[model samples]
Structure formats: structure tokens, C-alpha cells
Target chain A: MSEVLTYITEHAVQWGAVILLMLGLYIVMTRGNLIKKVIGLNIFQTAVFLLYISIGYVLDGAAPIVLEGAERYSNPLPHVLILTAIVVSVATTSLALALIVRIQEAYGSIEEDEILEHGET
Target chain B: MERLHVIVLVILLIALAVTLVRLRSLLAIAILTGVYSLIMAVVYTLLDAVDVAFTEAVVGAGITLTLMLAAISLTTRRETKPGKRKGQRIVGAATAIVAGVALIYATTDMPGLGIQDAPIHRHVAPYYIETGPTETGVPNIVTASLASYRGFDTLGEVTVIFTAGISVMALLWRWGKDDR
Candidate 1:
């Protein structure tokens, strides 16, 4: 049972991440709403983040700290990189959202097809 | 206990698939996308990547959702209808088949998950794990790798971020008439 538990604990995150990524892709592909597509993009990026972080985990590992004489520690590099990623993501999202606002102003509607139609006219 | 987690994962995956397949509204799709990110964050926590998970939760879930919603406010809710074309369907199907085949082929020779003796383990990973103690004095292997051995990669990542910001500003900034 413990072995089973271990296996589940280890593999669960990957499976979940894959599912989320697939779902996000589906939204991006199928959704007509520009905003919804952006949301899907966020989902996709999140799935990647989960994948990287999951790779960093070590069972029973201590926090990445250099104590007097520690034997094992959880990897911290993924964490640092992730922190940077968060900032980047925020900046990108805000910029994208701002563009959307401008797009709305230029065209009466936000629908992708409608915008194209408006442009054509 | 392990089976329970696996079951939950399966359920989540199923829900995700259903959402992808059936949803018609673009706005609903975006919200579902945010939920997917949140689920991914949970997956990261389970994997023990606490730091990465925290970042994902914030950037993916919080910030992303807000931005998408703002986009929605600016745009219409409806998605465009697909044009009638049998050729398009055939092309799409063929492309999807090729992608699936490629993915399967790529995975064929891949190492099993978490195998201690995988090539990645033998390569730079071991070097970092072994020398990290003396070189960076950092306990976290991931941190040491990013901040030290792979420090260059981190720098590159930062550069990318800077570029992205500049591009966004350049694209979004408005010209003023007061200047001249």
C-alpha cells in the first residue's frame, strides 16, 4: 500500500499537468472569444510551470538551505526560476489585456470574426 | 492512498477533456482555462515543487485570469463559425495524426520518470548535485543550478523578459501631440 501510495504521489502531478495543458490547448483552439483564448494561454503556461516544479521535488528532502551539516535538500533552482516566470507572466498578461482594450475601442465588438469584419468594412 | 490520488487525477483529466471538447462559448472556455491552471498548481504541490507551484498559482491563476477577463470586457463573447469545407477537415485530421505519431515516437526512447540512473542523472545533474555543496553553498539543487551552474540560462531568461516588456511598451505607447 505504501509503495502504491508512493507511486501515486509521484505520478499524480504529471498526469494532472498534462490534462490541464491539453484542456488549455483545446480552449485556445476551439474558443471564439479572444479573452477566452488568452485564458487558455494562461492555462497552457501554468501547465508548463507545474511540469518544471514537479521535476524539482525530492522526497524527504529538506528545504534548500545550507544548514551546519545537512545531507539532503529539496532543489531550489526551479523555485527561483519560477519566481522570475511569475513576474514575466504578469507583465505579459497586463500588456495583452491592454491591447485587448485597445482592440475593443477600435472595433465595436471583441469577437475575433467581428473584428475582422469590421476591419474589412 | 495512492490509488485515491490517481483516481482524482483521472477525474480531473476527464473533466478537462470534456471541457475542451464540448464548450462552445469562448468566455466559458477562458474561465475553464484558469481552472486548469489552478489544477496544475495542485499537481506541482503534489510533486514537491513548492516554489514553482506558488509562482504558477499566482501567475497562471490570478494574474492570467484577470488579464483575460479584461480582454473579454473589450471584445464580444461569441466565437466565429467554421466555414463549410471537407478539405479543411481532412487536412486537420491528417495534421493531428502526424502530431500524435511524432509525440509517440519521441516518447519511445525517453527515460522512465524519476529513474535515478537516467542520462540526465549522469550528466550535469550529478555534477551539480555533487559539487553544489562546495561551489554555491546552496542546499537546493534546483536553486544552485539556476543561480550558479546554469546561471547563464537565468540571465538569458531575464533578457527575454526585458525584451518582452520593451516590445509591449513600444506597441502600446501612444504618440503625443503636445511635443511638436
Candidate 2:
């Protein structure tokens, strides 16, 4: 019990993030709804963002602002990387949504199974 | 105290994710996704990635949500029932579990939270920290590195975003012939 507690205390955030990633994947894999799948993708992407930023954390560190006297700053590289990632994600989401709109217009349904059934018929 | 806060937020995020999965209403899902993004932005802020948090807030919560809602308005709001057979679901679950376990196992090799000597920190990070302000004359190291040290990468990212915008417009733009 004590060991379990120690592990949880040590790695709770990371484990939480990992669980979120799994949940996102589960949704993406199981859901027939295209929109839900997109939401899952967003969740998965954000989980990765969480993991990257968390790795850059420094104990007792201030934000990565350059100051004359401040000594410790959290690693800014991951933050920079994630900034670009966020914009890319938004672009992807918009493109995906636009595609979904077109899909709906073309197939009259956004559910994967429905679209497939229509194709079969 | 901070760890506790992070843990709490993580739990909340999990709860939101579960709810998002269970809910079948697309409108509700869209709103929940926005809320999830907002919470993620807060989490990023707590992790001292303020710039990331800002972008997540704008893109994740703001623009993405609006676009999703627009798409939802154009499509049906109710998701059909799970269409996959039991075997498919089982396979998917197995794959997700294997991947998750692999990722967790991989984390064992990673340096613990905030070790100053972590490999990631030992690399170009130190150089950026030491020279970023002087070289770029920017107080924010992230700004300096993103705009100066990695200018080409930023330019490429901008180009990608612009291409996406143009593609979306081209895909959606219809001639006025239908109305006429």
C-alpha cells in the first residue's frame, strides 16, 4: 500500500495524462461518429501537449521570462514546440471539420457505418 | 500543494473525457470539447507553458469549437449507435491497452519531474537560456527561440496554416450559380 501511494504521488500527473491518451484512442477506435472521432483526436493531441510541457517543468522555477536575478526557469523549448503544435492542431481541426461538412453533403450522414452502408447499397 | 492541484486538474480532465465519450449529442459534445480545451489551457498555464496555454485557449477552445459547431449545424446532431461488432471493439481495446502500457513502460526511462540534468535540458535548452535574451533581445526565451533561433521552422508552420486556410476555402467555396 505504501509503495502504491509512493508511486502515485511520484507519477500521478503523467499516469493521468496517459490514461487520457488511452481514453482518446478508445473513443476514436470505437465511435462511429466522425465528429466524435475528431473530438477524440483533439483530446489525444492535448494529452501529448500535456506530457511534453510536464517534462519541461523545473522545481521552484518561474515562467520562462528572462529576468536579471532569477536563476531557474522552466525549459522553454517544449513550450515553443507546443505553441506551433497548437496552431497546427487548429488548422487540422478546421480542415477536418470542413471535410466533415463535405462528407455530410456528399453522403447525407456523418456516421461511418451509415456512409459505408450507403456505399454498399 | 502544486502537485495536488495538478492531480486534481488531471482527475477533472479524465472525468470530462469519460463524459465526452458517453454523451451521444453532438452539440453537447462540441461544448464539452471546448470546456476540455479550456481546462487544458489552464493545465498548460500551471505547467508554466503560458504561450502554449494562450494558443490552446484561442485555437482549441475558440476557433476549433466554432468550426466544429458550424460543421455540426450542417450535419446531424445525434451519433448512431456503436456499429462495430464485439470482436472489433475487443481488438481496438486490446490495441489501445497495449499502446498505453507501452507508453507507460517507456516513461520509466524518462528523467523524473524537473531534474535539472535531464537530457532535454542539457541539450540546446541551456544555450537558448544563456544566449536567447542577448542574441534576440527578447525577454521571453520562448519568443526568442521561436522567432529567432527557429525562424525557418516558424515560417514553415505559418505556411502550413496558410495552406490549410486556402485549402478549406477552395473546398468550401461554391460559385454563385446555385443562388442565381
Candidate 3:
């Protein structure tokens, strides 16, 4: 039992990220709201970031910096990639929102079904 | 870096993600997403990725929330209940669950959390950690790697952001009359 708990503890971050990713998938698949879809995408993106950071963790390691007395550091490559990805995520979110605004302006309704119905006419 | 703390934070992140899915009001979702990202930032810090934590806190929490709220202001504030979407919901849930279980199963092959000599810590990482500061004069290894070693990646990142900016402006800016 204790071993099982330890296993759970060790894998918690990875499994938690998977769950969050699934939730994002569900949201994107089911929600008709475009903004909600974007939020769902954010959740998915954040989960990827979480998984990457978790993978880069080193036991008792210092943050990825050059220090005189530090033994080791967590992998810096993931940190670099994620830093760039996070900024890109914000950019993608803003651009998606901009398109949503245009959709609202053009169709006079943001609901997907309504927009489609208008299109049929 | 108490392991317990990480477990707690991961649980909190899951709870927050679940809450976000349940929310109907876009405004409330926007605010809660900020809170969620802030907590996620704390989790990143505990995992020894300070640069990532800082970026997540700032861009994920601050800038993303602002853009979400701005978009909400321009569009509807509340999500209209999607009509006859029951079949879609069931299919989505099924797919998500199946994929999630598969992903968790795949985790068995992953190195356990925080093993010092994990494969990821080998190869280029050791080279970067050992020689980055001396070569680039940047104390932060992440910065050195991003700005110096992986110059093309940073360049591509800039291009993505620039394209996104121009596209957003083109979509939202009023060029002629009858613009909303």
C-alpha cells in the first residue's frame, strides 16, 4: 500500500497533466463558444508546459543558472523552449480572440449553431 | 521542494481546470483562468524552473487574462447553451477519457520524477550547463540557451509573434466605414 502511494506521488504531476489535457479536449470538442474553445486551448497548452517542466525536474537540483557552488540544475532546455512557447501562446490567444470579434461583428451572433444557420440562408 | 507540496499543487491545478470547464460566464472564466495560471506558476517554481514560472505567471496570467476579457467585452458575456449537443458531449467525453487513459499508461515508460541522472539531464544539457556561461556570459542557462545556442528557435518565435500581431491588427482594425 505504501509503495502504491509512493508511485502515485511520484507520477502525480504527469498524470495530473494528462487529466488537464483531457479536459481541454473535452471543452474544445463540445463547447460551441469560440472563446471557450480558446480557453480550452490554453488549458491544453498549459498542460503541455506542465509536463515538460515535470520531465525536466532534477532531484535536489538548483534552478537552471550558473552558480559557483551549485551541484546541478534542472534541464534548462525545456525551460528555454517553454519560455518561448508561453509568449507564443499569448499571441495565439489574442489572434484567435481577434478573429472571434470579427465573427461576432459579421454574423451578429457568436454562437456556432446560429452562425451556421445564418449561413444556410 | 517537498514532494507533498508538488502533489498538493497538482491537485489544485486539476481542481481549477475542472472548475473552468463548469463555468458558464465568460467573465468569471477569465478571472479564474488567471488564478489557475498563477498557481501553475508556483508549481513551476517548485520544480526548479524559475524562468518558466516567471513567464507563465506574467504571460499566462496577466496578458492572457487581459486579452480574454477584452474579447469578452466585444463579444457575448455568457455562453449560450449549445442546442442538442448531447451526442457531441458524450462523444467528446468518451474520446477524452480514452486518450487520457492511454497517455497515463504511456507514462510508465517515463523516468520517475526528479531522478538526478535521467536521460534528459545527459547529452546537450550537460554541455550547455558546463560551457554556456563561459561562452555567452549569461548567468541564466535558459537565457543563454534560448538567445545563444538556439538562435533559430528564438528567431522563429519572433516571427510567430510578429505574424500574430499583424494578423490581429488586420482583423480588428477598422479600415473603412461600417466597421464594428
Best by TM-score: 3
Better candidate number, 1 or 3, judged by DockQ = 3
Q: What is the C-alpha lDDT profile of model 3 across B47-105, one tens digit per residue?
A: 99999999989888999999999999999999987788899999999999999999999
Q: Which sequence of candidate numbers ranks them by lDDT, best first? A: 3, 2, 1
Clash pairs for candidate 3 = none
CAPRI category for model 1: acceptable
**On residues A1-121, what C-alpha lDDT tens digit does candidate 2 reach at each position?**
9877756655777888898999999889988889999999989988998999989987678889887688888999999998988899888988998899889988999988889989999
* Candidates sorted on TM-score, descending: 3, 2, 1
Estimated TM-score for each candidate? 0.71, 0.95, 0.97
* Candidate 2: stretches off by over 4 Å: A1-7
* lDDT (Cα atoms) of all candidates against the true structure: 0.62, 0.87, 0.91
Compared with the true structure, the alpha-carbon lDDT of candidate 2 equals: 0.87
* Least accurate 10 contiguous residues by lDDT in model 2 chain A: A3-12
Candidate 1 chain B lDDT trough over 10 residues, lowest sum = B107-116
Candidate 3 regions with alpha-carbon error over 4 angstroms: B178-180
Q: Model 1 over residues B65-129: C-alpha lDDT tens digits? A: 76666566556565556555456446544554565455445444544334445454345554565
Note each model's CA RMSD in angstroms: 4.8, 1.7, 1.2
- The 10-residue segment with the lowest total lDDT in model 3 chain B: B171-180
